[model samples]
Target: MENVKDLNHKPLSVKQYAIVSSLLFGLFFGAGNLIFPVHLGQLSGAHWVVAMLGFLCTAVALPLLSVLAISVTRSKGVYDIGRPLGPAFALGFMILIHATIGPLFGTPRTATVSFTVGVQPLLPKNAVHLGLLVFSGLFFLAAFLCSYKQSNIMTSIGKLLNPLFLVLLFATFLLGFLSPMGHAASQTVTSAYVNGSFFNGFLQGYNTMDALSGLAFGVTVVTAVNEMGKTNPISNSKVTAKAGVFAVGTIGLIYVGLVWLGATSLGKFNVSPDGGVAFNQIMNYYLGGVGHAFLATLLTLACITTAIGLVGAFAQDFHKHFPKVSYKVWLGLMCLASFLTANFGLDQIIAWSTPMLMFLYPFAMVLILLSVTSPLFHRDPVVYAWTVVCTAVPAFLEMISSFPPVVSQSGFGKAVTTFQSNYLPFASAGMDWVVPALVGAILGVTFHLVLKAKRNGAVESEKED
Candidate 1:
């Protein structure tokens, strides 16, 4: 097969750029994208605006910046972004990231969340389990089939599915807003959001984990731009940035709308355990019986498209890194694994995913931040190494603190949390690594400067002698 990257190229037209942006948006928006924002709104209640700002920072901003980082750095994936640290470190980071966003957590979540929000509400109470099992099996099977052939079906399905979803979604929004159950600003805030709604919302954004995906799947966007004829790295980077802006901006608006819908719906419903529930409540309230079928179809299609992308990325990457394994074998294994995990239900899946996201998001954030700013530091390994090491220490502790109550409340967990609260700045806001990362970066830069000075002095002495 000819390399698309090597083809003769020209700049993309405006309409072509829109399609690329839509493809990026479709890949990045799925599962947690649908569940997290509404849930934040439910908790934020009267403080939803403040909460939305924070959510936008991490969920929308970081992910888009991650894509930009990839473009500017001319890197393919997280593995390339993290290469400043070391080959061993970069490879490990890439593996962990892909695994989290692959069969281990993210892919399974696509099935579970869709089932929760769409199909579960329509099923008889006792049939929830069987329904999920059947739905997930078919879901993964379809995704696997699409991915196994290394086809562009994900993009094709997304081009069709996303527009339909948007139309139905906008209709729901119009109905919800025109006849809101209650005004959102006057709603009561949940205990968690009462004091630090923005901070809490920021933490809630961690659930989306799109930053990691942005880094992992960035090359896909880059490749899309390349195929559109912007083959030069600089031109491709500019085009990718433009597409990322449009896509991320659109996703951000949708998130704000979802949050607003959730905040307004509180007059008619109680706080739900997940956004899937809030989504169900709103859909049912607006469209009544028909909404169930519509939601199921939209969500299932949305989720399956997401599943196809996740599976394809994981299988293709693993095959590249370990070529002894065929892409088809990797695809099959990922499907089986995701199929099993998805049966755990959406709530359980989200609950467990929290710990891992807690751990990995900090790394992703630091990497993206550093990658974007690498020119200032000349891409020093010392900077990446120190910042990562310091960040990892607290991130690991935060992971423990975020575990489900049963484990997180244990003696060991308490000790870890206590250490974090007592010592780490911003621990309570769920960003315990911020101060340390800054300090680490400072130290790394200082050390690098000192070494440079010493080497210069040595050269001067040799010349004088």
Candidate 2:
């Protein structure tokens, strides 16, 4: 019996890991992703190469690193990294993750993006907003049903649909590239890739929310593997790592493919600040009504799938915090909240979410960095606290500058303003927090090392005495 059991068990090979990780990574790639790079291409024109490099830095690298961090730690839960902060910090983190992925941003975006691509083109002159409201309501209603049940159907649909979405994207890009349209004259902008394209790209990637979502995703992946009756930590980590590699590869391919298509299409399209308008114009000219309709369907499906995933994630995390509240209740409440927000539209959702994302991003990134480097510091609470505090101070201060005063004009506001003037490096591209975070990390590690050495010295002295 023992021999039979031993023979049945096997480690996941590289290819298997790649396949599973690719699927998980695809979960992060949704419709909102298609617009930004295309707009950059139109704007950058000849400078598309540099702009793309910057964009890819965030869009690709951060997400891959997130997977690596999760795999390396072999954490059973996303909140495991927050052990230094105790339960309070973990609860807050859970709430933040849920809200960001749920009604606040991800869910509403589904309706908005879907409306713009799928429904708006076919609607009457005055029925645009009305159609958007009605369509979004029904869409969320369906998503609510799917998410409430935690159906495997949602997963199955996503697995099938993502490949189709890829096919459509390829076709759209091919058509745009082959045909001729009026081209915009390319112009270079000052400071555009001068202040470290990698950081800029990293910031842009933050907008995707993939790294934040990765926390929950790690648990989900681990649980799925564990369900296969694999209890060994080493074995679990191996499978998870393989999955991360696959996911990263898939994301890299999609980002590169779409960025290339957008850059090439820019030669025939005018440069515009509004990415949505630019995207629409490109589709209208190339594929006309049929193209627009196809885009709309894809957008709606993409957004809906993402919404279901986000809501489920939020419900799962919220349940972790308030054990009294059932998953169904939280899921329903989140769906209702998200549905209400969808009425506000996609641009509104994106606009409102920006300040929040900006505020939370530095903290979240610092957490990921801390988690990955935790081993070097022996998971010391002091290093975690000092490093996080150092990084957080600058991030919150920068948030004060970008966010409207009315939003921050309370107790938090006064502190934020003080930090901005005194602590933050406000001279540069609103990146006041970046340097401080790096400095804090260096100091944190140094302090940890010094403390370890002193403790060792004391032990030796005691032995001699």
Candidate 3:
């Protein structure tokens, strides 16, 4: 029984806490965080408030909870989250997470999004692809250079770029609100959001995938706390929690402002194809010609900082696993891969990434919840394994179902979808895993208690002998 109260050490002063909080916030606030809320606000229209609340549950609350879980468990990184399952599972899970947030999806997205919002609006329509090719080439070159030296990323992004980004973003929000853009459109709620705006917003937040990043970022946060002289587990955990509060508060305020901007743009601007377009429209309306330059600078800074962080984290992790490969080589490869994928365009990248997000988000949530509540179940591995297994099944099914109609209408896909729809509660709401996860957790706790009782009986019998 490691008592949390007994583990305390000296805490960080207010100034030290603020610096770490800004770093964590910068890490979590990036391209998707900016885009998703605006799109949700647009679609939610008059229901934006409800949608925003729902988004906060997963976007704001879950990531904050993830940071706390990391501190409480003293996890070194994302790998530690799955380590209780076994080495193979741990490695595989980590690889998937890194890949999802690195070259395969997240890293590419940053490039594509920056291009769409920052560069495309300025380019001639005929030269869009060529512009992307040239821009992404230069974009990734910068990211690779920055990420090559991971030590400087926090100081550069947190201390310099994040504040500038926040100021510009705050100005945009202030101007948009003060000038107004008519009330939210009276448009009928979109189909996905019609019945369950809250749930829809909850699922929409999954697109940000910050929860996964939070797990990966645990190492960064812990390292920062240790650097600040908070070495004990309880002190580290408390410091991390406090920093997480500040970070999420900043993130939450920005989200609300962005959502408001989107909601108000309803009748004033045409419904854009994606959030990036909507955001650009809002900026242009608020700041005129200066808005384009402002948006370009903001998007580039936001995307590059995030890209640097992801590339650095991915390269470092892989280099550790395959020591023969140098970190610099891994960083170069990741940046190159991301560059190529980014040319696929923002819309395509988002479409492809959604299914993967659907598959992984629930599993990430399950891990976070179990880790934070581990003490109640005596930190049993059986509990972790069962909960993960239960969550993974439905998550896999949902992923399959999210594929194109060509694939989803196929024999096996149809069968899986039917089974899920008929048997799983909340299947339609994209949360079919919830009940099963809860059930599995209950069973694991039962197993732990029974095993504990049996072990005590055996020990008592041996004493009698």
Candidate 4:
């Protein structure tokens, strides 16, 4: 195989870049992306604009920044971002990221969410489980088949599914605006969203989990960029960055539209258990029974495309690390795992995954921050270690605090939670790690400068001698 570095002798044309950008957008914008923003809008009520800003910060901004960070680091995957920490840590972190975004949580979610929003409504209540089983079986099968051809993924998702997905989403948005449901609701804002709508929206955005997925997705984007002949690291990074901007812009517009639809539906529909339910209500209100059918088609295509992208990315990363396993085998295993997990249903899967997301997201954000700012700190390993360690401490506590009552109410857990609340700034807001991370970065840079100065002085003394 030609080396990725050697492949970048030529740059991609504007059209090629656009194709890659569209592909990235499709991969990242899945069921969760659609549901979360709408849910936020519904809950925020009169405070929807502030909430939207918050949602965009974490949902759109963080993920876009992650892609940019990946470009700047010239990373092939999440492993590269963690490599400075140590090989063991890098491998472990990559495994966690890929697994979480793969069959374990993300991939399965595509099936379950689609089933809940798309298929369940058409069936009798008693038959929902069996229906989910049957539906998910077909869903994963399609995803497996689509993911089988790894090389053609960009063309498949970018050229085929992306355009169709956009048209459907745009049509829905246009209809929503043309016939909004009694304007934004005058209902009381939910208590959680009342005082700190922005913070609440930010937290809600974490449920989409795109930032972590972006790390894994970065490899796929880079591969597509390489195939377009922009292989050199610098050129690859530039193209990836440009493509990321375009992709995020597309995603942001869709998110705003979805949120608007949700906000408008507040007066007409009751608050839903989740975004899928809320979206279903909105579609039905606008299009009636035909709307359900339309949403079903849209959800299935959206979910399957997302599943294919995630499964392919996971398999590719694992195959690279463990070449003997083979990409096809990895893909098969992932699809099978996702199939079984999807049977647990969307709510269960989400409940089980939320704590883990909380634990991992801050760490991922810190790593991206460090990677993007590494040049200022001379890319020192100490800086990476310190920043990550500081960030991890609060993140770990936050995760422990989020555990189910059986664990979180235990004495040790209570103590940790108490300490966090007492001393950590923004602990109540679920952003306790921010200050510590900044402090770690400052300390790391200072230490690096001191070490460098000492080494330079020693070299000068030796030359004089």
Question: Judged by lDDT against the true structure, how good is candidate 4?
Answer: 0.87
lDDT (Cα, 0-100) at 62 in candidate 3: 95
lDDT of 3 by residue, 1-465 (tens): 234343335556777777888888888888888888999988888888889998999999999988878877778678888888888998998999998988989989888888889888888899999999999999899988876676676676678878888888878887887888867646445667777899999999998889998888777677666666667666777888888988998899999988877888886876677888898888888888888888988888888878877887788778878889999999899999999999988877888788899999998998998888877876689899878888888999999988777768899889989999999999988899999999988888888889999999999999999
The candidate maximizing lDDT is 4
Q: Supply candidate 4's per-residue lDDT for 235.
A: 82
TM-score for all models, in order of appearance: 0.94, 0.87, 0.94, 0.96
lDDT of 4 by residue, 327-383 (tens): 999999999999999999898789878778889999899898888888887679999
Candidate 1: minimum summed lDDT over ten consecutive residues — where? 1-10
Model 3, TM vs. native? 0.94
Question: Best candidate, TM-score-wise?
Answer: 4
Worst 10 residues of 3 by lDDT: 1-10
Model 2 CA deviation exceeding 4 Å by range: 1-8, 12-19, 151-154, 177-201, 404-427, 461-465
Error of 2 at 344 (Å): 1.3
In candidate 2, list every pair of residues with a backbone clash.
17-242, 18-246, 21-243, 21-246, 21-247, 22-246, 22-247, 117-296, 118-296
- Please give the distance, in angstroms, between residue 430's alpha carbon in candidate 2 and its true position after superposition: 3.0
